[model samples]
Structures are given as C-alpha cells and as structure tokens.
Target: MTRAMGRLLDDAAEGGRITPDEALLLYTDAPLHALGQAADVVRRRRYPDNIATYIIDRNINYTNVCVTACKFCAFYRAPGHKEGWTHSDEEILRRCGEAVELGATQIMLQGGHSPELGIEWYERIFAAIKASYPQLTLHSLGASEVVHIGRTSNLDHATVIARLHAAGLDSFAGAGAEILVERPRTAIAPLKEKGEVWLDVMATAHGLGVESTATFMMGTGETNAERIEHLRMIRDVQDRTGGFRSFIPWTYQPENNHLKGRTQATSLEYLRMVAVARLFFDNVNHLQGSWLTTGKDIGQLTLHYGADDLGSVMLEENVVSSAGARHRSNRTELIELIRGAGRIPAQRDTLYRHLAVHRDPAEDPVDDRVHSHVSSTALNLVPVAAAG
Candidate 1:
C-alpha cells in the first residue's frame, strides 16, 4: 500500500470515518487488491471472529404480473398479458410449508406491483401465513411495495407499514432499490417510486419500530460517484433512524430483460463496490455478499473484502433467475466455499440469530438439489419428447 493509502486505512481502523472524497479516491484510484485488503481490515475490526454467516431462507415470488414497466426488470409481465399470473393463497402456503420442511426460517414474499392486489389482499395473505406458520418470519416487500400499498389503500406510508406489521410482516428484503440515484433509477425503474420516496418509507417503518435493511444494485450504468452517493444516502438515514440492520450490494444481471443486455457490471466492479460499501457505510452493522448474482468464487472472495454474511442458501430464487442468473449452490457447497475462504460457516435465522455453527467441515450436511427452476412452471414448462 502507498503511504497515503496506509494512512487512510490506519485512520479508518482508529475510529475515524473516511470522507466522501477519500471514498471516491478508493473507488476510482486505488488498486483492486489494495481495496480488498483495506476492506478486509475493516471487516476484522467489526467482526473479529473467523466465522462467516449464512441464512436459511426462501424467496416466494407471489406473482409476476406488474403494472410498472421497469426497463431493467426481467421478472414482471404486463398486467392482463398472457404471461401474467398470481399464486393462489393455497399455493403460496404450500410453498411456505415446503420451505419450512427444508429448514428455512424465513420466507421472502416478493412479487411485481400488481394493480389488482389491494392493501386488503396483502393483509389477508399475511394474516393467513401467520395463522398457519407463526414461526416463519415474513421478511418480504420493499419501499416500492409499501409505496404502492399506501397509494392503493389511500393511507400514508406509516399507516401501510403499521397495518402490514399487524398482519405479521416481520421485515423488508430491501428490494426495489436498484441504484438509489435519480438518474439511473429513472432510467431503469421509471414507473417505480423515486429514490427519496423509498428512503422515506423505510424511515417511516423505522419510526414505527419496524427495522429493515437497505440494498443497492450496482452495474446498472451508474458511476462510481453515484454508487458512493447511494451509500451516503443510506448512511444519512441510518444516522437518524438507525433502523437499517444491514446493507447488501449486488450486481445487475441483464439477460432476457427489457434492457437487452445493454450494459452489465463486471465481477471486479462488484467486489470493488462491496469493499467500498463496507468502508463507506460505517454506521451500518452488517454487510451481506450476494452469491446468487456474483457466483461462488466471487462470493468467497467477498468474505475477505468486508463481507461478514454470505447471504442465503436460497431454497428457491426467481427474480434473478428470470433475469438470466443461473448460478446455484447447495448447503454443503456454500459451507465448503466459506471454509475454503478460511472462515467458519454458521447458519442464521432471519433475525441474524445463529442457529447452528459448522465447526467441523467433515460433518457438514450434504445436499445436491440446488438448481434453477422456472418461476412459472405450469405455464412455462415443456414436456420432454421421447425419441424412438
């Protein structure tokens, strides 16, 4: 490391925060390896233990029909279109049952912004899920959904959050926050809520004692300054509300999407953003790496770059898969990757509670059922043709 870079790291480690200018230099000027090293130092200071964590959860996308025609989204189908569909309550509950059977402690109930589903629709569904599986945490929705609910129900953001909380909405998955910059946000997700509106909804939820995490989508043609600006926005909000539990950054997958693979972020850029996120978001407590988007190798490399969480061994994922991300890994594979990175792996619940720690790698549970399945099987499935 250069003398200036060493000084910056020393100051960051000694209780001093890096300025936005320094962060810009790190993002644009610093070498990739040096950035990773600095971020690793920050990670050690925050979490000294050698153990990294993973969550056991499933993403249950309720519907793909949406009114908002976000350019970057490959998951949503236009409302009333032939491809549009919503899961029945029974089907949703059955999936929840499967997740619980697979030892999942959390269900991320996410979907598109359907105009037909009103606030009452969410209340009833959430209530039914809670009634049946009271132990399962409903870590679902994002600010965009909340904003839609508020508009649909003719209530304020706080009212929507409170009602959802009453209906067993435990937390948010921090979806819909692609870039948090107005230009790129408008460019990609024009019909969705604005960047500040998303933050406002989160702030309102925090005020009502409903803590949630924040997310950023990198490689959407956003500049490095804009990425740091995104973190600064979240950090400023965390400074006041302190409701953000973690900050997760993932790369944008652009396949089978409306953008038509216009631009995609590289693996190195993804790691740089992750490292910069840890260095910049000093107030945030946790940093999660997205293996689903970045793949296993980059995922392991992230552990040394300020990431303490390996995201989730997703029992199922639809959003990214719909967007052409096919990377998949089972529980044993994830554990091995973490171990290879020289960190102990622990399974965690939705609330970050350690359920079980795998100290002996030899004893890791083996499972080989990890693969991407179509989001809509009934409509999209094709029967195999037997050849004579």
Candidate 2:
C-alpha cells in the first residue's frame, strides 16, 4: 500500500470518515489486511459489545410468476409459464406459523412482479400475517417490487409504501438492486427499474418512516469502479435520510440462470467489498455478510473484515437457491460458527435488537426444529402447522 493510502486507512480506522474517492483508492490499492483492519476498527468503534448477530427468518416467495425477466435470476418463471404458482394467503399464514414455531422473529415476504397482483393483494397478505402473528416483523419487498406494484395499481411509489406500511409492512428487503450502476443493470435486469428509481423509492420509504436495508449483487461483470459507485450512491442517500439499516453485498450466482456461469466475485473480492463498504458507508450502521450466497467460512471471516451481522439462518430461500447457492445452516451450527469466530453469538430481530444472545454455548437453546429448511411450505408436503 502507498503511504497516502495507509494514511487514509489509518484515518478511517480511527473513526475519521473517508470520501468515496478515497474509499475507491483504498479499495483498489490498499493491502487486503489493511483494508480489513481499518474496517474492523470502525466496526469495533461502532459496536463495542463484540457481538456478531444473525436472524432466524424464512424467505417466503409468494409467487414465482414475474413479468420482469432479469437475466441474473433463476427463480422467476414467466407469468403464464405452466410452472408458475402463487401461494394462497392461508398457505402463507401457515408457513409463517411454521416459522414462528421454529423461533423465527421476522418474515421476508418477497415474490415476482405479477401484473395481476397489485397493492391490495399485498395489503391482504400483510394484514393476514400481522393479524395472525403480530410478533413477527414483516421485512418484505424491495424497491423494484414497489415500482411494479405502483405501476400496476396506478399509484406512486410513495402511495405504495404508505399502504404497505399501514397494512403492517415493516421494511424492505432491498432485493432487485442487482447493481446501482445503470450499465450493468440494463445489461442484466433490463426490465427492472433503473438504479436511480430504486434509490428514489427507498428515499420515499424513509420519508414515510419505513426503513429498509440496501443490498448489492456484485460480480456480474461490473467494474470495480462501478462497485464503488454503487456504494457512493447508497451513501449519498443515507447521508440525507439515514433510512438504510444495513448494507449487504452478495455475489451473483450463475447456475440455472440466464447469466449462465459467466462471471462471479471471488472470496477475496467479496471480503474486500465488505471492508470497503464498512469504510465508505459511514452513515450506514450495519454491514451483513452473505453466507447464503458465499459459504459459511467466508461468512465467518467477514466478522473480522467488518461485518457485524451474518445475515439470516434462512429457513427457506428459493431465489439464490434457484440460481446456484447450496450453502445452508441451522440455528445451532450458526451459533457455533459465530462463537468459533471469537464473537458472542446473538439472535437479532429485524431491527437489530438483541432478542437472544448465546453468550455461553452450554446454554444455547436446543431447537431441533430450527434446522436448515427445517419448517417450510416450499420444500415438503408436511402440514404447515404440524410440520415442526
């Protein structure tokens, strides 16, 4: 690393902020350890408790029928495809019941952009889930979904967000933000909303008091400069609204998708992005590493590279799985992974509150039902309420 880059990292490590240009310089040239070291410093400074958090939640893809055929995704089927399916509200509630029985505190309600399903469809689902499981946090949808729902319902993004929030939606999942840069997005998810439109929707959500996490799907042949530019865009929005709860960066899966086995980010590149994001997104508080997209080992290493949270013990994940992600973890093993990484293990709510902390492994709650794909409506024919 150059002397100037070392100085920048040092300043950032010591809680001093760096500009996006400076962040790019460090991201491109600084030694990997140096970048990680600075990010760890920032993480320690931000969270002094030395806790690494994870959430127990299920990704309930309400339907696979979509009109926006993103090339990088393998999960969606065309609206009229013979295989397309949408779950009934009763089935969705039953799935939520299974999740809650298995100790889930959050429900990620995501699906495709079906032209027939508008804001009312979502409102009905959200209302049902909230009515049945009032304790479960509804961290659902993303900016792209909002845009689709708005267009279909002849309403604006703000109106969509307002109705969803009033109907018990808690926050957005920040999905469909493949990359905030325009070129790659057009090249891949051409039918999706533009990068600016996605950000604008999130800003509107923040204005309406609905916070959301921001995410990036890297390694789809995006330039490193573009990666930094993505961070810059999120940072700028965060500076004004502070609505982004966390910044999650994951690699694009290639198998079973239109992108094919084209290109993807390496583990080192993922770590570097994690560190750079921690340094660049000073306004954003949490940095979550994707063990679901990457492997569990890489997820463990991210705690040292500035990730404060190791995403979810995803009870059911179909999007990335449809692409190529095969890694899975249960509650016990996830806690062990976090503890083995030298950080205390904690189960967090959607808002990052410590719902349960496993400070001592001996006292770790034994929930056999919390295994990977343990309780779901996606994988088995087991009755939803009787599955667990």
Candidate 3:
C-alpha cells in the first residue's frame, strides 16, 4: 500500500472518518488485506467485547405476486400469473408458530408488490401475527414496499408507515436497495422506487421512531464510484437521523434470476465491500456478513474483516435461494463458526439485544429446526387471491 493509503487506513483505525471521495479512492485502490486489517482494527476497537452476534429469524415470504419485477430477481412471478401464490392468514400464522417454536425472535414478512394488496392487507396480517406471537419482532418489508402501499392505498409515506407501525410492523429491511446510484439502480430495478425515495422513506420512518438497516446488493456491473456513492447516500442519512442500526452488503445472486449467471461479486470483492463499509459508516453500529448469499467461509472471514454479525439462520429464506444461493447452516453450526473465528457467539434479537451469549463450549445449546433453505413449493402452488 502507498504511504497515503496506509495513513488513510491508520486514520480510520484511530476513529477518524473519511470523506466519500477518500473512501471511494480507498475502496477502489487500497489493497484488500490492508483495508481489511484497518477495518478489523476499527471493529475491535468499537466492539471490545469480542462477541460476534447472529439472529435467529424466519423470512416469511407471504406471496410472490409482484409488479416491480426487477431484472436480478428470480423469485417473483408477475401479477395474474398462473403460478402466483399468497399464503392465507392461517398459513402465515402456521409458519409464525413454526418459527416461534424453533426459537426465532424475528419475522421478516417479504412478498412481491401487489396493487390489490394495500396497507390494510399488511395491517391485517401484521396485527394477526402480533396478536398471536407478541414475542416475534416484525422486521419485515422495505421502503419500496412502503411506496407501493402508499400508491395503492392513496396514502402518504408517513401515513402508511404510521398505520403499519400501529398495526405490528416493527422495522424496515433494506430490501430493493440494490445500488442506490441512479444509473445502476434504474438499470436493474427501473420499476421500483428511486434511490432517494428509499432514503426518504427511511427518514420518515426514523422520524416516527422506527429504525432500519441499510442493505447493499453489490456486483451488478456497477462502477466502484457508484458502489461507494451508495454508501455515501446511506451515511448522509445516518448522520441526520441515526436511525440505521446496521449496514449489510451482499452480492447479487445470479443462478435462478433474470439476469442469469452473467454477473456476480467475487468473495474477495465482497470482503472488500465489508471492510470499506466498516471504514465508511461511522454512525451505523452493526455490519452483517452475508453467509446466506456469500457462503460460510467468506462469511466467517468477514468476522475478521469487520463484521460484527453473521446475519440470520433464516429458519426459512426464499428470495435469494430462488436465485442460486446455496449456503446453509443450523444454529449449532453458526455458534461454532463464531467460536471458530475466536469470538464468543451471542444470539441477538431484532433490536440487537443479546438474548444468549455462548461463552462456554460445554454449555452451547443445539437445535435441529434452526436451519436454512425453504423451497418454492408455493411459488407454483397455484394463484391465490391477493391479501385483503
């Protein structure tokens, strides 16, 4: 590394923040390991506890009937397709029960944007789930979904968010934030909400006391500057509201998606993104390694690079898996992965509160149900009516 780059890394390690331009330069020019070392230093200093955390949650995909069909998604079927499916309230409640039985503390209710489904649809389901399983935090949906609901229901963003929050929605997930830069974001998800609009939704949500994580979907032929620009946008918002709890950057899955297998983020590229995000975001507290999309080896390496969390066991996940993500692990394996990385394993809740910290190997708890991979039996299970 050059003297200037080394100084930049050192400055970052010493708790100094770098400007977006400087970050872009380092993100593009800095050597991978050098950047990672500095990022790891920053992480160690910030999280002195040496506890790497993971969450036990289920991504309850309620339906796959989508209108904003992005190029990179292989999961959603367009509206009115013969193969579309929407789980009845009973089915959804059943899955919630399953997740709670397996010790899941969070539920991520993901689905496609159906015009027929307005805010009342979400309100009904979210209220039902909360009534049944008040222990489960509903960290589901994204800004785009908020926008879709607003348009469909003829409500403003704040009103829609207020209604959802009143119902049972706990927080927003950073879905549909592929590449927040206009050029690439429009290229991939042209029909989805704009990049700035995504942040606006978050800002409004944060204003109302609801917080969220900012997710990055890298390696879709975006320029390095655009990648850094995405982080810059999120950071600017973080500076204002301090509402973002974590920043998760994952690669684009290609196998079963519409973009085909043409583009992908290499393991090294993913690690570098993790390190850069750690260095750039001074305000965001957590950085999650995407074991679900990037594989466990790289995910484990992220603990050393700068990530404090290993994301979820995802009692069920269909979005990325539908697109070719093949990694899987149970709760036991996740704990071992953290311990193997020389950090204590702590299971966290939706709000990042530690539920259980495994400080001793002899005391590690094991469960058979906390595994990944949910097939698409319902994707083609036959079209069900949209949620009311």
Give the per-residue lDDT digits (tens) of candidate 1, residues 28-48: 877788788888888888888
Q: Which model, 1 or 2, shows the larger lDDT? A: 2
Name the TM-score of candidate 2: 0.96
Residues 290-335 of candidate 2: C-alpha lDDT, one tens digit per residue: 8888999999999999999998889888777777677878888888
Model 2 segments more than 4 A misplaced: 375-388
lDDT, candidates in the order shown: 0.83, 0.88, 0.88
Superposed on all Cα atoms, the candidates' RMSDs to the truth, in angstroms, are 4.1, 4.2, 3.0
Give a tens-digit lDDT track for model 3, residues 1-388.
7898889889988889899898888778898889899999999998999999999888989988899988888778888788778889999999999889888899999898986799899999999999999999999998999999999999999999999999999999988788899999988888988899999999999999999999999988898889999999999999999999999999998765567757778899889889999999989999999898888989999998999999998888887777777678888999999999999999999888999999999999976766874433423323232221
Alpha-carbon TM-score of each model against the true structure: 0.94, 0.96, 0.96
Off-target runs (Cα >4 Å) in candidate 3 are 374-388
**In candidate 2, which residue pairs get closer than 3 Å at backbone N, Cα or C atoms, i.e. clash?**
none
